[model samples]
Target: MKLVWTQIKNFRSIKDSGKIYFNPNLTILAGKNESGKSNILKALECFSLDKFNKDTDFPIDYIEEEYPEVIVHYQLEEDIVIDLCDTLKINKENAHKISGVTVTRTSEFLESIEVDIFKDTLEYVIDAVGEAIKVINRELKRTFKLDINSKSSYLLSDLIEKIDSYLLTIKEFFNEEQSNKLNSIIEEVVSHLEMLNGFSDYISDKKFKATIPNFIYFSSFEDIIPDSISSNEEITPIVNRFFKVVNQNPKLLFDESNPQRRRLLSDKISAGISGDFMDYYSQDSVSLKINLDGDDLNFFVYGTDTQKPFQPRQRSQGLQWFLSFYLTLQAEMKTGSVLLIDEPGLYLHASAQEDLLGMLNNLSDKSPIVISTHSHWLMDPNRLERIRLVLKVNDQTQVENKIHKGADAYTMKPIFSAIGLGLNNDISTFGERLILVEGYSDYYYLEAMRYYFQEILGIKIKKFKIYPCLGSAQIINVLTLLVDSETEYFILLDNDKAGRQTEKKLKAECGIDENKILFTPVKSKNTSVIEDMFSQKDFSEIILDSLDTNKFDKVLVSKKFNERMHNNEITILSDETVSNFKEILDVVATPKFSHREN
Candidate 1:
């Protein structure tokens, strides 16, 4: 089962969050600080919690003293519904009506079925007996001067006996064919009545609970306590729970009698933590050890650089937080669980945050993760479909699942910061007129070309800020932010299918003017990328400098350029690469800005 939507009322800052929809794999709740992003995660956490606190959780604006109700709606998968039916003893026919099925008394079962087939059969039998009694009464009154009253006790008993005998010999009352038809009708009616009764009984007797998805909520990294400190505190329960999950026996942590079990558990945990540490640091010789100091668990890491072992607290805060979070998830989380992480990359550096992002993405394959984040490195630009904008409106929290094309500057600030921070370079504050490119290499090449054109052609062009959009797909997100900033911008996309599609989408969906969009000029008929703007010889030389000369090929230069650019190395544009670059600048610099005095 998956949580398709959520609505919170009278919960903290959110009065009524309307209906916040979710993506199956990953849902990112993004907003400014104090926009109640964490509150939304907490509301979801309520589903898994055993008790609720009205005083702390309820909205203060509520005038009446009433308990707060947090209602969450879930969608059950077909397999889950089938399993539920089997568990509840609900037959296949009745299972179809599970969503609408209600308890009804045995006396009220007849009213529950609209098609009264059982009632009709009883009526048919009663009429047949009445007719036979009428004939008997007429014959008795004429021959013996005796009229039989249908309501008289003796007459009723005699008539019931005759009806019973007639029903027993029902086959004799009709031909073989008629008997078969009659029996079939009676059997069908009987089966329908039995099914109705059984369904009613099942509904009345069985208490079926909704299959609530398991929710695991993680807030700030500060809440994560190191395994070294052994105390009966808030984190002790989580540690105990994690140990039980990892070893299936919490006693192994303290049971001195079972040294073998203790050793085995320690080795397993040590190997698991060491493996994660190696993957994280990309070092083969890194070793991790888990030791029990009295009742407390301690972690010690040994790196290839240092012979001495150091505790986790001795490491950076970011590494400590990440290790704790990762280990906790590994030990505590089960398959099909829903993870709610609040500001996951809060402590990590931008690069480490990226690694955390990748880990979260991989973890999402096993369980759906809904993360509330202000970090751009955490948000996947390619998966904008999973983003939800949490905003404060009229003092109530509102979550918008749809990404607005015309999002204002304030709303787009976090995204802009995220993108800019991830690039590790601030967008040039040269001029309001922005020149957007597909990638970093494009920005570097264009800037070099602009200078070359100014020097060679003696035409001083308007200096526009060269902004790299990271990818063609991310252009719209940047544009949305730029438009809000009232920044006049022009796009230079690669002459490829993806670039063309992005250009078309920018024009149609984002309402970008067609004249503002430009494609790289290429001599060949093949689809042109940013690398095409430069001479093949110049680009190949740059590639050779970065990669092995033996690996250099005309066909592989473009791919190599991208690889080099990702490593923050851009090949400077030469004089020979000026024509295509000059052409693009000439068009963009036309009547757009005040001309520079020659």
Candidate 2:
């Protein structure tokens, strides 16, 4: 069983976060501080078995008589479904039609993980009863046929009762062998109905809970442990994580009397941790050491400067952060549980953050991570699908994953950072096929369009990269780089006066080929700009979200449209929109190889 989707409602900072689809590996929640990024992690933690704190969780803004709920959907594998059916003794007919399992955890003083596996059972039972009735009618044409095609109850008990009544009149006609067959089928169906009569308490709540994943939330920054702590002090989660490493065996870890035994146990754990740390951290000279005293547990970092070790504080914060982050997760993480980390990239430089990212990728296979961060170094420039933009709009937390050309400051800066615009060297580094759009807005729309064609339309578009330039005037400046690199490229521009002027300049003055210059809405009438391709209603609505009183600043509209697409709230429903995008897609999808490098 794997957690596939989730939504949190009536929770802190979020009236409703909408449905957030996981990336199958990890979900990166990116935004600036106080954007309610951490609140997302907290809300998900509520999914942990029988856990809730009303006083702390209930938001002051929400006064409605409703439970703060977290609805989780899990995809149960065929093997898991088969096991569940066998354990629950469900009818084979019902079990065969199994679908995803949904678990809704709600807090209204009494908290519970309410599992809904009944959909599969109900769906199958209805159709199975209908089909069985047809068989019964065909089996016995002499007696009154069961006209139960319109039967709504679909209950196996109801079907058994009707079958028994029909059998009473037909048993005299059946031989002993035929009578036994009918009797056996009726007896089996009747037993299954009674077994599941009262929602299958016999299935066991524990058994159901077993399939629902338990969420384990860990924050490296918040839970970073002190260097030394008394044995009597309350065990912080970090310390508990340490205890977990030794399998909670405190004897050897705190045995001050036998120095050799304590040092021996500490060395073994330290060596294991240091080995794994080196795998990601790449600091060969550094080593990890632990000191077990009867009064306190001490952590030390060994460096080449001296044989004697120094405290973790003496090392860089990045090193300390990684140590705590690594130990805690390695000890606590279990197979099937999702890991929630808040700003795992904190205190790390670019290289170290990337090292942490590699560690996270490995851990993702074991326990998928949902990380909240404002850092760009930790982000993968390639997988924009992993990012969920957490923003506070009207003070309510909103999570989004898509954007369009009309998006303003609300999307531009973060997306640029998420895509590593600053971190990346240049567009020239990309592969052969490149599309140079006039500006940021053009780039956004084309990217969104490319995604629509590939994902929704199931059309395998070209592996092309879209780069933006400073409008028609800067086309030569960008084209110069493409020519020098010998990268095949095309100029995508508007059908306006300025674009037409630039197109002539490129062909006549720069010796550029006409075929290499593609125009948006190229085939559409009365469409000058790429924005003109979309229906007026869609273009205006997307621009409206920019919250810009001035026309140019309304960037929110495009972002909203992209978000809706990512959220699956909307798609290319408009015939005009599809026609307009398809017009552009037809050009971009095709290879334009004939380019005069000048």
Instruction: Give me the candidate number with maximum lDDT.
Output: 2
Best by TM-score, which number?
Answer: 2
Off by over 4 Å in 1: 65-67, 84-210, 227-235, 258-265, 280-287, 293-296, 405-408, 417-425, 428-598
Model 2 accuracy (lDDT, Cα): 0.67
Question: What is residue 144's positional error in candidate 1, in angstroms?
Answer: 49
Q: Residues 1-598, candidate 1, lDDT per residue (tens digit)?
A: 6556666666788877878876767788988888899998887776466345566676777556443444554555667557546744556575444432211111111112111222333345455544443444453452212233323223223433544554454445456665564665445434433444443344333233334566778766555535474534344644654554456454535655466766787888777667765575431355667776567667677777756878867766776677667765565456457888888868788788877878777777666889998777786543444678898887778887544433455666656554332233344332467778787556555644554455434566775666667689988877655555645778999998998899889988998888899998868766987667778877667645655667554323433343234333553556657667766877677663234475
Q: What TM value does model 1 have? A: 0.54
Error of 2 at 175 (Å): 31
Per-candidate clash tally: 0, 7
Structural RMSD, model 1: 18.7
lDDT by residue for model 2 over 48-159, one digit each (tens)? 7546577877676768775588878877667767766676675557664554766666775433322345544444444444444444556665334445432233443454
RMSD of 2: 11.6
Prediction RMSDs, each to the true structure: 18.7, 11.6
TM-score of each: 0.54, 0.64
| Candidate 1 global CA lDDT score | 0.61
